[model samples]
Target: MLIDLHKATLLVIDVQDKLVPAMADPQGILARIRWLLQVATELGLPTVISEQYPKGLGATATALTDAAPQAIVVEKLQFSCVAAECLPESLLAHEQVVVCGMETHVCVLQTVLELLALGKEVFVVEDAVASRTPASREAGLRRMRDAGAQVVNREMVVFECLRGASHPRFRHISKTFLVGEQP
Candidate 1:
């Protein structure tokens, strides 16, 4: 099923400073997540950013926080955001969630599984998430997909959110954000 922008919230999980450096293609993942955050902000999607034990892992990267100043920041001790119960009511109310962030096999995977269990539609952005190794990254994606989450790319979410060229921001979004983006 296609993502419904109005019904969806953007969930950025554990893209913290210390944690980011340990992931594979750290810069690339950060760039994609940052790009998605910018698009989500422009499109007016409610965004939630989770920082897992920030004191130890460090806060959400400045680049991301700067990208979407309006994002609701949540601090969680649990691997799964749902288990931590720190998410704001506004974010939990959404029917769908577009997710990105670090450590695909751990935090990202646990959160996606729990979100799926809650019966919410979960879309995991592949290129926007990573692990220290390609094997673990692919494993996380496989597990999430097997558990009923739709694995997608950043542009898929963008197009689905915009729906089509008829969208008022289509021209601007395409030109500004999606210039050389590939599927």
Candidate 2:
């Protein structure tokens, strides 16, 4: 199913500061994620960010927080964010979720599966998720797909969300968040 921003939210999973630098190509991942937040904001979609054990791992990366100032930052001991207080309730009205973040195998994968089971249309940005080890990251992507989450490329999601140039914020979103186009 196509994700409608009016019916969607962006759930960034565990892109904590302390943990992020260790992931491969961390900056590239967060930059794309930050762009997603900008586009989501222009579309007026809400955002939720979760940090797994923030005390130990540190809060979310500074750039992400800056990009999504109004976004809710959830601190959770549970690997899956559906267990976090207020988050599930806040997301109750949202039927579709666009997810991106770190440690793909452990937290990101588990969260995607749980969210899917809860009946949300989960769209995971493949390029924006990672694990310290490439093997686990690859495994997580496969597992999330196996559990029925839609594995989508970044440009596909952006264009789908934009729908057309007639969209009111089209030029602004394109100018601010659009990265280099691929072939």
Worst 10 residues of 1 by lDDT: 174-183
- Give the per-residue lDDT digits (tens) of candidate 2, residues 98-148: 888988898888888888888999999898787898999999999999889
**Each model's lDDT:** 0.92, 0.83
lDDT score, candidate 1: 0.92
Every model: Cα RMSD to truth? 1.3, 2.0
- After TM-score superposition, the amount by which residue 74's alpha carbon in candidate 2 deviates from its true location, in angstroms, is 0.9
My TM-score estimates for the predictions, one after another, are: 0.97, 0.92
- The runs of at least 3 residues in candidate 2 whose Cα sits more than 4 Å from the true structure, single-residue gaps closed, are 85-88, 179-183
Clashes of each: 0, 0
Candidate 2 lDDT at 109 equals 86
Cα lDDT for residue 102, model 1?
A: 77
